[model samples]
Target: MTFNAEPFTYRIAKSGDVHISREGRLVVMVRGNAAAKLAAALGNGDESDQQLLARATGNYKRGNERLAGSKRR
Candidate 1:
C-alpha cells in the first residue's frame, strides 16, 4: 500500500514558535530552545525529517498494518 510521503507540515511563527500540523490540523506547538532545535532538524526536509515530525507528534505506527492484496475488493 502507498502512504503519504509528507503527511506533516510545519510553520515558524514570528515569536519563534514551531507549529506542526497534520492534514491542516494543528498537532503541536513547540517553543523556545526546543522549537529552534526542531526547526534546524526539519531543514533537511528528508525522509528522516518526516519521521522526526511523526514521532514528535506521537503519530508513529502502532502495529496496525495490512498488505495491499489483503484488502477486500
Candidate 2:
C-alpha cells in the first residue's frame, strides 16, 4: 500500500485576495471572511511552518492596521 498527500500552494492575488494553486494551475479564489479566517489561523496559531505562515501573519496584521486606519478617517 502507498499513500501520498496532495501538494499545497497558495498566493496573494492583486486585489489582496488569497488563492490556492494546484497541479501548476490556479484553482480557487479565497476572499472575504474565508481569507481572513485563514490568515488568522496561519498567523495566531503556533505552527512551525515558517514561509506561508509568515506571509499569512503579515497579511492579517496589515489588514487589521488598515481597517483601523480607515476608521480614523
Q: Rate the local accuracy (lDDT) of all candidates.
A: 0.79, 0.53
Candidate 1 lDDT tens digits, 2-70: 246788888999998989898999999988998888887887866777777777776466556555348
Residue 31 alpha-carbon offset, candidate 2, angstroms: 0.7
lDDT of 2 by residue, 17-66 (tens): 77766566765667888786665555332333334433543442344555
Write down the TM-score of every candidate: 0.71, 0.43
Q: Give the TM-score of candidate 1.
A: 0.71
| Residue runs of model 2 more than 4 Å from their true location after superposition | 1-6, 43-73
- Residue 58 lDDT, candidate 2, scale 0-100: 42
Local error of candidate 1 at residue 69 (angstroms): 18
What is the lDDT for 20 in model 2?
62
Our tally of clashes for model 1 stands at 0
Q: What local lDDT score does residue 16 receive in model 2, on the 0 to 100 scale?
A: 60
Clash pairs for candidate 1: none
Top model number, lDDT: 1
> What is the lDDT for 23 in model 2?
63
Query: How big is the positional error of residue 59 in model 1, measured in Å on the Cα after superposition?
Result: 4.8
